[model samples]
Target: MTTTGTEIPGPAGLPLLGSMLDLKRDSLGTYLHAQREHGDVVRITAGPPGLRVEIYGVFSAEGAQQVLATESANFRKDNPFYEEVRQSFGNGLLTSQDTDYLRQRRLVQPLFTRRRVDGYAASITDETSAMLATWRNAPDATVDVAAETTRLTLRAVARILFGVDVESAVDVVQRSFPIIGEYTLTRGYSPANFPRSWPTPANRRATAAMDELYAECDRIIEKRRADGDAAMGEDLLTLLTHAESDEDTPLDASEVRDQVLVFLLAGHETTATSLAFALHLLARHPEEQTRAREEVVRVLADGRVPGAADLDALPYLTKVLKEAMRLYPAGPVVGRQAVAASEIDGHTIPAGATVVVAPWVTHRHPRYWDEPERFDPERFTPEREKARPRYAWFPFGGGPRACIGQHFSMLESVLALAMILQEYELEAVDVEVPVSTGITLRAAGPARCVLRPVGRGTGPA
Candidate 1:
């Protein structure tokens, strides 16, 4: 039983299907429009009769904090999208609930500490250098930064995750993730979807991709087990293999495979989205780009590639990435199911309602962000950051459920951006990158930039 407060406001919809068409047509735009038009909390209804779905949109930063942190116990990863992902992938950290989540978190926490992730910086630098080398060799001066960054982040994370087995893992991941992402998105949003056993084209493709991905991860895990201590190394896979060493029981073969699959999905995709958009944003703003490059060049004055130690020294570059993530968060909308009724902004949210905290909308809230659409890096300066609410600029979702790989993501982004800016001046060819939300945010079209080589001597340093 819950006390009734103010009636929750929302957009009126058609007779049977509410805003489903509008959402399916333009999900991000619809969310933004709802927040702007309907204050902070807006109800969105889809489906009809027995199956009507009501999604409570929490747009204010305060509301976001309540849902994700302050009243986190009231919410869990029990939404449709999470269920879709959990079924396709396994029950990893991203979708595990309660005790299972706690156990997984405890086992995996040590591997992602700042000190441990810092050790992977060399692998990141090597991969960044290789990516740059590919750009230099490309016949076309204009390259799609979105595709390039996806390839780069995937390879880098794969190498760190699989060690010697990265080669076999890379191609499968690259080819299968897009199929899986699309399938997840399409089915996750539809008010009604066909059964997997029905064997539609989409189902066949998604099923095949899932099988391929699982098979590959199992193969890698089996090989690592066969190699034993004689070939054990410091890669993520090795650490996971021994994850249970500290506890009473070890992670089983399926558990190891599930964790690896989640890592490959979350590790590469989110960071790749951030890097691509950061470069695109910089390319569009040459003055900001110049300032960022100057900072990078000055910090790495010795001309050595930036490692994890140098991350703090390049503050402006870090700000640039932060600002980009603010404008275009990779995980635009995070969903949770309410276990009990809760109040947000004087409104009573009924129990069993689906709730969403959109970083994409909250990051652009009119109250906290001045000129929310403007590209500004100074907004992230230390003094200014402290002045704002903690949840206001959450590119990574907040609370205990916050991204485990955040340090690694930042390390990869800042290092790769520094190295790339050191060698080339980027100019955008396609100024606007139309994006859509899948399992993560994705560029619907090409984000192409023309790269002009620059001399090290000519840099600000």
Candidate 2:
């Protein structure tokens, strides 16, 4: 984020409060509306931080990209929001910066690389098949599509990454993840300043829950070590072990524990949420679902199962997934803190200013997209997609700080949906799915839908 001249008119950032109140209320919609009214490059003078902050939401994507990439030297990834997360997770990649981030990414990147993840694609297919078979989608048999999607992704990740069964840890992981992931609510209280050991019941429970989850991870790592199969396939744990050994800089057990914590928290949940939203969007727009089913039908030719080879053949499947992400983005926004003064589009941002670039805002900005609210996957066709700005649909973010798991996530979501489209129809029927945003957005209630078994063989050209 950069600074401006003396005449940059800003919205009414509440005195001693800043835009936090407005942000707290409706996060995405409210912020974008403010941007539309107060020009794109608006600053909120946060009284708490006592600094003039810049927002590049409805403005230019270039500004957001600059903050995330080129001009990133003046900013840090671990913002105020991350300070409270320290108790739950130590210095892991999600909140780490610079060298720590580079090291952790190097260690964790391989686990999700194309070649390695393909080795586990069969497990993904199997997991999706099993989940679909279990849900017969009767008229009254309400299913929380969000929860089920998370459960499936979690199970597949656990099995493929750490060689564990997510079923055994489902309740524990699910409950713990969302509670702690409520970053907007928890950002105000720092563990160092306002410790959860105090009387705040919700905070106390969340901290304890995170501790237990980490303890479980430690036990899993211990068992894996004891089993002494370091030569196992290029799974996450295996990659960590091998990478450290290869560099002759072995990560101690605690560090390995941290990686596991971050990887499980970051890698699995977000992808699951994206998949859930993908299904939800598909359910709402039957035409896309029909197209997906048709593609699946065409692909299952000659007993060839849906594998890595067929991953890219389903162009419509990829388009539908991308469109869903634009509507219901998983990582709604990215935040940063300035280490020094910066300037962008004539906006003056002081040092120590808190900055936010909301993808939810950019994805829906009317100036950048046509029918931004419509559920239209054709917007992503090879021809039309080129007409929009790059950041207009950055579900996985962009540039150097882009999600490292993009390949893994794209592969998992497509294959999971493909497998489902091949077997069952997940039809939404008068389901009231409320939005609950956290580390990811999930349905607050059951995504009630009628399920009908499609013949195991229908899809599109």
Candidate 3:
């Protein structure tokens, strides 16, 4: 904590081919155009014999809450981009380390606290009205609507994490969790990067689909602990079979099947890529999808859908799901490791470098946004999002290694945006096709729309 009166300045780079070839030609708009010619903090590398290390670009949200929470003992998601995603998300607790990720984040942080995610808001409004009754609209009706909002939040996180629906082996666990998001992240730092075997069809279909999805979660955790069903259905695999730690030891079956495959690959790809970028930004903003369909019929008029007392009466559908996670941010580049030799603003980051806390380049930081590539969802109301800069707006990342399904991906993205604004009306069908980052931020494909029906008394008459 000694970064005194400026003298840092290490921008203009070269090193073993630093500035990572303009960050591999346009990763989050070339690192926000080198943060407008290097300001916040910048230094790059990825050279060596392979995937080098060292990067800082903090972009102050209190310097990302002092490196993910008060310089948490000198920055650390604990190395090499969370050890290349804990080699296929095995160590789980989002790739563990220190004290085995602080004892599995305090035994799975009381099943996502906030009163157990407001008791799963009536199973996320009954799995978003059974996925808006298969979105019908007649005349050659269609609906990919981002693969049915990621199969209705992966069948409501497989009924709140294993009460049911291992859905006939979910396509061998969704074709093996995108082979850890198409590895090649900086061409893998040769711990023997394997690409030779059987023409790599995404690493031979994720080694033949995570070996039958870990033998069907090890026979449903050995028939839910041999019929004792571990104090029965409290979901989340019965709260990790009543968690324990502080030497009280528990969690074994291969560390609870790698923490249930990190809550089934981050509980259905970050709420199905934030409800498919909030239905492709409310089908290209038809006046903010008619003010989120008149606040979902002025707060579920009587057709009764969103409960948990209508999630505080839909604050404009929670600002259109926090401006569609501030324009699509499902784990957009987040890596860490510095456990020694630190120096942010003035740049050093020596000890085991490799850092990249990018929330897609600190949520479009034009020194706290203005027309930051507009899609202006009234800049997240609440007085224009308190004029920006709370870490500019991290998606689901912050302290104590954030994102333990951040409130079950924010009430499954506000119960699938109030069951698709309580039965459709999204007009404009082709505006939002921009985003590209793979392992989460989607829509380089099916964003197509057209789900009219808001007729009968035109909602909230």
Best by lDDT: 1
lDDT by residue for model 3 (309-408), tens: 5666777777777777776788776767667766665565566655566777667776666766666767787776787756788888888777877766
Q: Candidate 1 regions off by >4 Å? A: 1-6, 245-248, 456-461
Worst 10 residues of 3 by lDDT: 1-10
Each prediction's whole-model lDDT (CA): 0.89, 0.70, 0.68
lDDT of 2 by residue, 1-461 (tens): 43454355566667666676666566666667767788666665433553434443325676677777778777676565666555567677667778777777776666666787777788788888788767764335445677788888887777665665355455567767767677324554232245556667676777777877777777766766776764456557656655552443566677787776666776677887778878877777788799888888898765345887788898888988888888777877777777886776567666776777777777777877777878888888887778766766777877776887788788889898887777667678644466655655656676655555675433310
> What TM-score do all the candidates reach, one by one?
0.96, 0.88, 0.35
Tell me the lDDT of model 3 at 164: 66
**Whole-model alpha-carbon lDDT for candidate 1:** 0.89
Give the candidate number with the greatest TM-score: 1
Better model by TM-score: candidate 1 vs candidate 2 = 1
TM-score ranking, best first: 1, 2, 3
RMSD of each: 2.5, 3.8, 19.1
Better of 2 and 3 by lDDT: 2
Higher-TM-score candidate of 1 and 3? 1
Clashes counted in candidate 2 amount to: 18
lDDT of 3 at 300: 76
Worst 10 residues of 2 by lDDT: 183-192
Task: State residue 83's C-alpha deviation in candidate 3, in Å.
Answer: 13
